[model samples]
Target: MIAVILMLSRGSHSRSHKLKSRALICSVLLWMSTAVMTRSSSTSDLKSKISGVEELLEEFRKQLQQDESGSREDEEDGDRCISGFKAAEERIIRASASIEQGAAFLSAPQRVFSWRDCAHACCSHPHCTAAIIQEDLKQPDDSLRCYLFNCTYRGRSVCSFSFQPGFSTYSRVNNSSRPHEPGRGSTATDSPSLDEPPRSDAGQDLVVQLPTDWAVLDGRDSTDDHDIIHYEWALVKGDPSVKMKVTHPGLLKLSGLREGIYTFELTVTDTSGQKSSDNVSVSVLAPAPNAEGQKLFVYIFLDYF
Candidate 1:
């Protein structure tokens, strides 16, 4: 009975050790599975982020390419304009008198391989009457600035200054269309000098009240011979060819006006029935957001007064 009891104890101890060994193995396998899953999740997240960044980079590159292509198309179209002159042939005016001032608009410095390239750019633009090439001595040989200008009635293309070093001006001369002076040039047009249209104070922007306003249109004769006896006011910009109602003595009372841009044309007639016209632009601004409150205050004050 004692030996049998000892044998039973040994069997129980062995069974407990085997059970503990199985539990340890199960724990190690679970830990390894968790670590592998975590690694795989981390790698997947990294790959996703990298893919998003690449897509964004590709989109940015496409946008840049589109912009560059549009710019190239604009350059090819040759839509550049200077000084309101168009389709005029470029004539090289070497060491011309006008320097410095007189440019209606000055363009930013453009890179030109040679002087001829600058001239070609000027000629291609419809508004470019003259171009001045300025050399940038500090930069490379291709660095040049192109200045555009409109030829004033006076002989001065730019300013009265003398020739400047490292600068040359090229002017657009319209031989086919320009009216030739009788004494100054070989051929002369049939139009007489006296028949030149009278000058008026127009081409200026104006602002006025909405719904109702008083305006004045005055006409003056350049000859000052009291010959400008007739005046007419017309609308050219707003509502298209509408005529303005005229009060006596060149006073214009504008009424029924909405918020918009309006252009008024004035033509004055001399005794010889010669008419000269000018245009003025008027802009009607929209009422401010606080206009109603201010208007109520004004009405109250006016009633009290």
Candidate 2:
């Protein structure tokens, strides 16, 4: 009976050891599964974050491209506007070549605008086929008048335009159907007939006989202000010894003149500091043979008397 009891105790100890071993194996398996699940969750989160960053980067790139394209388009439009207006100015000037001194055409309502503003205004207006800028000599530099016209009118002198000087006209060609009527909405009146003669006293070439001794060269400007007038003379060509002495405003004296063709320039400056120059050609003629014989007789009579 003692041997049977010892054997039963050894069997019970072996079963307990087996059960403890099985529990330790189960705990190890549960720990490993928990670690794998945590690792998988971290990988998925990292991938999702990377995808979000890539999408954001793509969006930013697209926006940058759009901004660059828009900037280029704006620059192109500005260039075209300037070029168009410049072309118009050239065309109008050529068309109004018949007018002397200043150009006059059938113009639209006058608008106070700058060169660039005038260009944009012409582009925007439906009836405006052309544009012109006329500067007021009496007004300051900042004050400029813009005239828009649908049709061009040429063959008018500055006198017909109410003595207004410094008028410039510009035009743009439209391929659309039907051009606007001339003088319909024109603020400027109809110019007088071309048959009318221009003013004789108006600025013209000076033709005079060279003096035998000292010749007084007189230059006159019709400017309203005489106090602010500044006179300048320069010998453009001909005799080098010829000298110009400025006596006063619009007055020059030639002291050392010879018998030859001499070209002299007379520049007049106004109160606004605007300068205008006119070239005068002087012709000096030698004394005639008959004049010397007549002078000798007159001198003999004077001596005898």
Candidate 3:
């Protein structure tokens, strides 16, 4: 009986040890499976984030390319105007200078940030053959002021140079254009060379019939070495009721005339602002009776006799 009891107790102990070993193995397997699943999920999330970053980088690259292309186009446009122009150092003109007799401003003075910008402005204008730029010491950015002009007197370039502090002059280089010759001993104090004024020709006086109430005043023969830019007509002594119309520059049409003497003065200005004046007279006479009407009246009187 004692041996049988011992055998039963040993068997129970062996069975309990086998169950505990199986439980330990199952716990290890569960832990390893959970660890593998967690690692895989983390790897998928990392790949998604990497894809997002790559897409953003591509967009940024495309934007950068577009910006570069636009910048290149802007540079090309700016180059078109400033390419054939050259600048003269330390030579410019003042607004109040006596140079106004031989030159006229192409436009109002413009404020710019650099001399290059001023030069570009001058080149852009069709009539601008020269330009002057001066730095403004009062401005915080040290900005520049630009003045554009054709600088011609009697069809010749009157662009003379003188010493001016913080000033530069720019002129176009063209085979057809004349070179600007600086005057000898030209200084800030000396007066610039002057040119002859334009000549105005309000053509020969006219005689018109009273039935014809209109006259055409011709000033097309006005003479200027530089081109004529403006023509002004005034009724110095005429019928105040007369109407004057400018058909074009240096040409005028007069209307509302009567049997009287009408006098007009033509003042012509050239590109260099030099002007000359001349006068013309138009005499409107009473119209003669119609010859046919007089003959008809004579026939009617003969029939009455």
lDDT, candidates in the order shown:
0.55, 0.54, 0.74
RMSD of 3: 15.2
Once fitted onto the true fold, the runs of candidate 3 whose alpha carbons sit more than 4 angstroms away are 1-41, 65-83, 93-104, 123-127, 136-141, 150-166, 175-215, 219-252, 257-305
Which lDDT tens digits does candidate 1 get at residues 243-278? 356676444556655677888877777676766667
Error of 2 at 291 (Å): 4.2
Task: Assess every candidate by TM-score.
Answer: 0.34, 0.39, 0.44
Residue pairs whose backbone atoms clash in candidate 2? none
Off by over 4 Å in 1: 1-13, 77-127, 132-147, 151-305
Model 2: per-residue Cα lDDT at residue 116: 66
Candidate 2 lDDT over 177-281, as tens digits, reads 122233232112342222211111113333344457356556663332223356677878777887778787667687666777777776766555545566777
Give the top-scoring candidate (lDDT): 3
Looking at model 3, report the run of 10 residues with the lowest lDDT sum: 175-184
Model 1, position 293: C-alpha lDDT score: 90
RMSD values, in order shown: 22.3, 16.0, 15.2
